[model samples]
Target: MEKKPAGSSLSKALTMLNHVCTSPVPLRFAELVDLSELPKATAHRQLNTLLEHGLVRFDEHKQAYYPGYGLLALAHRTWANLDIRDVAAAPMRDLWSSTQETIHLAVLDDAEVIYIDKLESPKSLRLYSAVGKKGPVYCTGVGKAILAYLPEAKQQDIIHQQNFIRHTEHTLTTPQALEGNLQQIKDTGISLDLEEHEIGIKCVAAPIFNARHQVVAAISVTAPAFRTDDASYETMKGLVKSAADDISKRLGACD
Candidate 1:
């Protein structure tokens, strides 16, 4: 039997890693084989390589594979290196004080939205998500807002790379529908969560541009459903947009 090419083996390993990272829970070898579309022997070899590299680990009790400490270490380093968190701090605080809602700053990473900063509202009933949490780009307001302004090729690449898993009944699961929504967000300069990612959380988000006028991040205000009636939603939308615009301007985005 001929040995597979190095590129082919590397591709299989990456596919397996991607499968483990995307899943909400650990995956069994069978699951990895099905998702990666690789032969059982190939999958085992790739998984073993990943395990040796500390990119994957197996749970003995459950007999499932999960992302290993290597990924978490890399993620931590990446987050620390990004200056967006420092740049967003003052504005996030202002937004939090003004809207009295949870404020979040998120950036697009590997086709997902990763929260880098957050300011919790003082109110007892506020929505509570944390920094470093990852959310689907098609469902969360911050994700959609940034995605709306991304380059067409990058957007299409992300759409093609991942399966649109519906987190809730309201989640947009089809590529066409997501594209339509992105168009609307680009036109309006605002995006809405609408309880798509979480049942009771509603968020209004807008894009944050950089010195080159390219959108590099998004800022959002999230509140519970009970506090976000039609009128309040509109108010929060305007506030979130204004805050995002101010931050963009601070970063030298104009027009």
Candidate 2:
């Protein structure tokens, strides 16, 4: 076999790691050599480096290579910091500017949504919400947006956890009710909080996806219900969804 020259050490390492991480099943040594297109000696050396660094593990029984806990640790750190806030910065600003409404970036934590980033409205009247505050997944726009896109089993788990506290008259206080609403949001790729989380507040939200097309976060544009009429909500919906899509793309989501 004509051996292809391995690129820079970093590139070679990344190429091997990517394959290991992306493979649905463990890869044998021969399979990796063929997949990476590196000479056997080169591949062996690179595999040794990866193993030493805890990037991959070799199964002695199966004679295959698989991702290691090191990758999981790194992923935990990345998710803990949640670079989505930085990726959504510009788009969130644009959405806020377009709607002149309060903007929120939230990620699902267990059954609740944690407000990780917030852009206050330029207007005098803004809803009461702050970064690090937790909100219910069943009643808040950002929360519902994320919950709606989650896997069915996860959605059920979170839904089961909700206390169904009615914050306002509009709040859905039953699992059946919330489930129907989530189904609508899942179909539309949008969510709305019609004074469900807080009285006199309303918002439009959309889910943000990661590279694997999983819903990792959400964004919302909120305003006083008195000022947000049907027509205004229509406009805000488009802006919020567009901004979420932009942020998701920045995060490497294909759709």
Candidate 3:
């Protein structure tokens, strides 16, 4: 490796991180020393600094260093500030006005769907869902919408993680049942939560795709089943799908 020129402290740390990431396997301290072209003492010192900050972790078993959970937290914080949320805001408001129902924007976290934003319903009926709260992906409209579009392996992994402790009588408590629902969502570009997560509560949801056509988040309109029969549910489905499409487009989604 060529000698790296002198640079800012932050720059050097980033370079070290990049070096470790480029390796196909976790790197030993000596390997990192060679790959970063830094003196052994300097490499050791810098790696310690990174370790303290949780940017890197040393595995006692493997005797190697790898990325740490702190970086994952930082990435999540960055995702929170992404322009996609801002882009979806106006569209969410417009959809709420048109439907006169509570709306939500959510992102998938591991095995749950985390509500990132919500616009409450104007009618007297209130729901328990609130921003930052998490619910199962196997039982909620927004949850299933995003789950259906996830890469197959990741989807299955999340399904495995689910406890399947039923929240309602209608909840899909088994993998086989949930798989069928997800397949329907993929085919229709819409997902329905038919009083599955909350009794007498239902929602219509659609997946939001990013520029690469990857499902990143979901939008949903939720209301009581008593207020919306199947006919009204169909109308809500169109509105929700349209709103989702608009947000996806603004996020640079092509299709």
List residue ranges in candidate 1 displaced over 4 A: 1-82, 125-128
Candidate 3: the clashing residue pairs are none
Candidate 3, residues 211-253: lDDT per residue as tens digits?
Answer: 6688999999999989998798999999999999999887667
Tens-place lDDT digits, model 1, residues 1-255: 433434567787998899998999889999888878787888898999999988899999999998999876776676447587777778888888888888889999898889988888888754436788887898899999999998999999987765788888999999999999999999999999998988988989999997667889999998889888899888888888888988887776777
User: Would you give me the overall lDDT of model 1?
Assistant: 0.86
Q: Give the C-alpha miss distance for residue 252 in model 2, angstroms.
A: 0.6
Q: lDDT values of the candidates?
A: 0.86, 0.90, 0.89
> TM-score for every candidate vs. truth?
0.66, 0.70, 0.68
Q: Pick the candidate with the highest TM-score.
A: 2
Give, for candidate 3, the lowest lDDT window spanning 10 residues. Answer: 1-10
Better of 2 and 3 by TM-score: 2
Best by lDDT: 2
List residue ranges in candidate 3 displaced over 4 A: 1-81
